[model samples]
Target: MRNVVIGFLGTQLDMGKRRRWRPTVDLCRTEGFPVDRLELIHDHKFNRLAHSVKRDIEEASPETEVLLHRMDMDDPWDLEEVYTKLFDFASDYGFDEDRERYHIHLTTGTHVGQICWFLLSESRHIPAALIQTGPPRGGDDVGTFDLIDLDLSRYDALQQRFDQQTREYGDLLKGGIKTRNVAYNRLIDRIEQVAGLSDAPILLQGESGTGKSELAQRIYELKLQRRRVKGRLVHVNCATLRGGTANATLFGQRRSFTGQAGTERAGLLREADGGVLFLDEIDALGLEEQALLLHAIEAGQYYPLGSDAEVTSRFQVIAGASGDLSAMVSEGVFRIDLLTRLNLWTFHLPALRDRPEDFEVNLRHELAQAEKTLGIRVGFNSDASEAWLRFASAPGTLWPGNFRDFSGAILRLCTLAPRGRITRAQVVDEIATLERRWRAADTDQNSQLVAKYVNGPVDPFDIPQLANVLHTCQTSATISEAGRRLFAVSREDRKSRNDADRLRKYLAKFDLSWAELNDG
Candidate 1:
């Protein structure tokens, strides 16, 4: 490992305050990991600290590769430019290997360094370890020295999180898992069939946290493998997109245009060409931006920010929204023409309550994952699981947060449980806490009505007009007689719907129906 070349990109003040470079150099000397080079990247803001560290490094290791990359953390380089520079520099120093062997140690000491670190890791899919600066031993007045320790677990944890995210979101890419959901599955299958193998634009409609972005990623990965598209996956959260100096963030902008000096940056779409472009919370985009996106999807082109150069953006476009884009278009909140362009394909991810069966498997997967992440053991036995199911299946469990809520609940139980084995009562207690939280948010009359409906009358025969009779019978056989009588007309016809069709058909629960509500 002494042959390994390490580059340090962080703050000069931070380096001195935390003693980051000294400890690393010491470790290199002690552990036989040769410190071949040292590059202290700093801005004008840290001029004093930069000069000091530069002199110290020269005295400590005269032969070390000392470079002072002068640029503001924010203005220095965007993620793509950083990748371009780092790879170029690495190649210049003969750091290339057939496999992924070149290691870049990004030290986060300032806001800019942290952002670069996050962006590089995300864009390049590179593995990294975090090292925090600590106080010196028996030093007075917050010792100005960096104590560095490798955060090895961060890599594994990030990988596991990424893996779980892929499975959960990847499942939604095509038509999703049919065995887990009939209504949703059929819709997904139909949509996939409609989308065909061509790179048609896809629009996803659902509330926030419903995994719309995940679905978009899944589509990209699947289509890449299926169609063998030779491009990278690019995702952007439209809600967080900003203009101003951040123009280079979403769209490439001129480096010399601003008072700051830097190189021109590349837009995200350009980097993602040939693969997939996922525009998350697309409804948040202004009308003009929406038009630009529409033109890109339709005409396969767009203009980079602060530039007259028209860049061709020919890639699979997938947009997600929390509300009905069609309605927004009609109400003039969104553009109708743009909506038509996106309506070429649409997929709606069902909420948790809408697909109860998925919960059992999803919950199990979540628990297993949580156990692995937290380094704790946890599981549910038959009785405890039954209790959980009862609580989770109860009415008003729309779980607006969907699988995220389930994951949170399981993780909470794991954290609170004794010796890792969570019981049904523990689940119930958590539910009570959750309910309390809901109640706290329920100050208005509508919330009170919801509270009444969820916690009030136990009307066994209460059935919504849309409730399925077969599903009711399957869930509770005691309601079979009532359901048969309630659907007597259909029974007289001597016809029964298939399982998938059954969900759409009406069934009597607690012997209640639209007529009973009318009578009341």
Candidate 2:
């Protein structure tokens, strides 16, 4: 089997052009390289591009069997089916693994063709190269750009370097990816809609814990699916911006100016110039930075740090804020003009407490993720579910930290729990501890004492409230008649109606009755 040169061709119908690698294909032939096969991926928009590429490959190389893989990035992929089809086709054609030559040539159309190429080459431990064709209108070097031939094998020795870089990038995106109450299906719909629109500064408004970053990424991915936006998603957190450091970070400072090593660094905006630029915690950005950002978005231009030349702004800006940016504008803390510009398609993420219906779904998702990541089969029992509901439904039980808090709590419980399964009692104990921490950390200083009391060791003298609760549980003849009660009441209140309500409310919170407790 001669080397099968797999060229993943991406096209843009909106741009009115299809990316053709016939020239690159010819380059391989000129070099006497055995280009045995080709695979073309057309994401929904370009039927003409797909057919054109197929016909061109067939005519150019009679021995090279061209395979067309149809996909819509908006639709959920069946990974198993895709894998089966790909390998099956290769098998039928007797594709030799050793002879697999993958060259990712990005045709002249839209931007996302690069990512499509990345996806194909990453499927196997094979070599790949990326090249740009002429611009959408056609001509040499019109769409031409520098090429990056990725060497995956080098990544093994540079794991720490890449891990550190990726982690730093992810940290900047933390505020955006935080879990919230937005419906998953609705989010997907919004992403697809955003992809079709042109030059809109998207405003993703939500509470502190809502996942705006993930939605921003979804928007980027969906746009890339269109074949127009080609660059990778670059995230920036305005909150973490420091004085005198912001400009240098956004527009790379000259290496010679600071005498730093390595080639000139690219800012997030420049790196994602042709794709999506996610601005998280945009509310935290300084007035000057905000002005610059507005200019970049409105005029499609920016001045690099320590440079007199102006650069074209080719990226789509998606801004995220935790609170009401409009109100901030009114208060003069934020620029009204900038706010108006960014508030193009605003989406307010609801808090988790407002979406009680999503509790079960969120819990199941978190647990499954934990099992997969940690290689553990931890599970919850009926009682644990009841306990979780009690906390999830409580008046002050708002998950301020959102899904992140929930995930952390679950991970701790799974690690601390016994081998069999976690029970309601265990969950209740964890919730109590978590509640205490939240209270202590909150702005209200009065809550500190309450939080301390709940977390501290229980002593009879510490709280008279426990004595009142005991009196109600013990003196209820209805509870006694249901079953033999175990706890002895403090001699404080044997016949208080108010006491009965307290006991009843507590039991109701856990979906249990006084009779059930007495039965135990």
Candidate 3:
């Protein structure tokens, strides 16, 4: 097997044969174990030193290809930066594990560099065995080396933990197996591992209908299975938390004192004590409430509306936001520090439109669910199944609603199928029905948008005409300006050029004046 070595060039790597031997030179010269390649990474500051080491290795073993790469990092002591650069370099380069067996040389460079190499090897980013070199044992110029293959399975505790967590995730999958999406399943696996390992706050970000709420519930269920949590999974929609009532609802209401609102019962935080708390649309939380929530997360203590004694709830907060909290933070709508606390583990659920490949699988899963819920087993004939697949999996079909749309399609199919088996005709009718429904909804939405300009109701049938007229008027600053715009195009062809009067006549057609639309 061809052995490839990856490591950072140390300050002592090129030390001549005074008291010790060089790792690169010795590894290449080791008897009966020829290294096919030595990939040395170093900063630009070590350009001359790197060149000298490369020459020494070449001289020691002309067969070994000593490929030197210049890595960009400001500090060798910065573990994050060093690890990131090395990981990126390994990813960008052709480090194909199928082509060669690799070894990570951890003996050279700073201690931070060695640790980064170890982590990269552990994570399989380097896809190599970690090799640590020691001083020559026989007092010769060569050194002794230890090669460690970082296979977690070999470690009983870690392997068992991984297996147990994976099994728990598989259990969670049972509750929402509406699709066989590989990417999504892999995401679930990662989430399962994170959920098992940490109860730290998790942030779920995705568009609407991406199943964030369901996933959060499943995570809670898995935790329950593992006995990680001891209380109920308390969920609260932050969108509903508005005004003074929002604070009382979240933190707890104070008992009534004349002319004051009293919250005698426990709030969401208290309800979720020692359990999982899911906050949906977390961005909707007001600034003051956000501060209190932040304090709760940090200190696990908060005062109720009317009480001075700080009530406590050791709740594991999983906040969900439909949009980017960072953007909101930039706009001063969200607290940066609070976001930073929740940002530790953020998972983005992708929209359904991007995963069309899983449509058929999801279609079947949804049907299975319908079978249980509707109390009737439904089967799709060959032709109907094929037809549905064509429309559902087609690139042009935008499933803007994601999984929710998929479920809705199944609902429509199940509701319409009079017989147990679905036929091609039914599929055609349903597709047509959905198309018309979506188009009408789109048109209605457009009409409603146009309606925002009018102070009073306009004829719904005339929305298209009114929209066209309003769009044209917006092209110019005033009625006269708009009139000139229209006349500019047609004045040459018209017998009489009365621009403003013509504009006035058009406005009269819509029962609207220029001032009405442009009142800023």
Candidate 4:
């Protein structure tokens, strides 16, 4: 394979002192690593120097071919301009990997140029290994040269730095909480990669309060930190956009349409130009809005309400959905095209009940947040801490509202704690309040289920017990499992171990049968 060396013509280094040889000329005369062709990149101002270097290279190694490529740069230190120019040059260059091996010389350019070269090579924009040249250490004028392959996995230190960076990105998304849930951590890792690497529309699917909005904001912030975005993050809850005004609110409306003397409004889409648009509860968007959004996302152009001129807003979308958008599309309530675009990078955040392992970590985080907000450092007593953990980590505990419910509980505990100390009494009280709130939210749905079985209106006192029993029955695989769970404390005392029969007897009170319930 022919060896092709591409580098910037070092104006000062190539024009060396009286005794020293030019680095480029010396590189051509390298002992074993022979350069078949040297592609020297320089500006118009250094044309004479480039020619002189080429002449010296030809004299040093008569077999090597020297090609001068002119790349004009107002400032070689401007990373963006230098990178773009170099990228264009590399793109235009005819590269044949089968016949020619490429090497990017890093010793010639400015530090900024060197960085751009490294980025381009590492990203495989230029299919080449980096060749760095240094001054001669001994009597050999060719100097010492090192070949650095762009494959990062070959270097343990570089790989470790990348791994650390990935972890930091995950941590940022997690609000600095060191979550121990294996599945959640893996999900965060994938999200971190997608957030940094791609601008494709991201669909965050999870139950309400599962940190979808928070994760979207964090993704925007991460992109901003990486300089991937310039404009601010525009957050809009699609659920809030309703009625005829939804169209005007999202895509903007002219003052003439409003029939008022006010400035034209640039809607959420335009507001998010050059940045990110976080549409929380995106499934709530009407069909018309969804179609318009799809067009904007795909074409980067959309017409505002009552406007003929199409406005362009090239923004990345991080959509949040609590409900199943695919199911909605099946039902003809959602646009399949929009869902298809958004589904390219979908991440489902697990519910709090599903990730019990992260309870303690999130608990501590919420406590710290509560302390900061309340301006008081509250500490839980040993017994209180144990009680809190036990209740939160219980098998039957259901966190329907996920982190929001958990955070609210912690805030309440901190708020109600006496003298900045939460004792067992406070823990017990908070647990009761949480259980009551959760049960109250389920009462209406559970009551309807109970009403279907019973002949008459159920007593308010028996409703909670019946609701719990019905829920257990619906969720359990078999009658025995439900019975074992429901009568767990009392079953040990009973000599007869017919749990199914016991469950049947209990259900018989409301004229409900196991087979009938399961069949229904």
lDDT of each: 0.61, 0.63, 0.82, 0.89
Model 3 residue runs over 4 Å out of place are 1-152, 155-182, 258-263, 447-520
Residues 491-513 of candidate 2 have per-residue lDDT tens digits of: 24445535445556654643546
The predicted structure with the larger TM-score, 3 or 4, is 4
Cα displacement (Å) at residue 61, model 4: 7.2
Model 4, stretches more than 4 Å misplaced?
1-25, 31-128, 132-149, 154-156, 446-520
lDDT agreement of model 1 with the native = 0.61
Cα miss at 277, model 2 (Å)? 0.5
lDDT of 1 by residue, 14-49 (tens): 464655435334322322334455555556787776
lDDT string, candidate 3, 85-193, tens digits: 8878878877776779999888888888888888878888778888888768765666787778898778899889978767657657446464567777777777888
Pairs that collide, model 2: 111-228, 111-230, 112-229, 112-230, 135-143, 176-213
- What is the C-alpha RMSD, rounded to one decimal, of candidate 2? 20.1
Which is the leading candidate under TM-score? 4
Q: Order the candidates by lDDT, highest first — what do you get? A: 4, 3, 2, 1
Stretches of model 2 off by over 4 angstroms after superposition: 1-188, 196-199, 256-264, 444-520
Against the hidden reference, what TM-scores do the models get? 0.51, 0.50, 0.57, 0.70
RMSD of each: 20.3, 20.1, 11.3, 8.6
Can you list the residue pairs that collide in candidate 3?
254-306
RMSD score of candidate 1 (Å): 20.3
lDDT of 3: 0.82
Instruction: Compose the digit string of candidate 4's lDDT tens values, residues 1-520.
Output: 9999999999888889654766788888788999999999999999999999998889879989999999999998898899899889888887899999999998987999999999989888899999988887777545888998988888999999988988888899888999999999999889888889898989999999999988988999899978889998999889888898888778898887767887467788999999999989998988988888889889999998879899999999999999889877866889999999999999999999888888888878888999999999998899999899999988889788888889999999999999999899998988899889887888877788788777798898898899888878876778999999999988899898888898999899888999988766
Which one is best on lDDT? 4
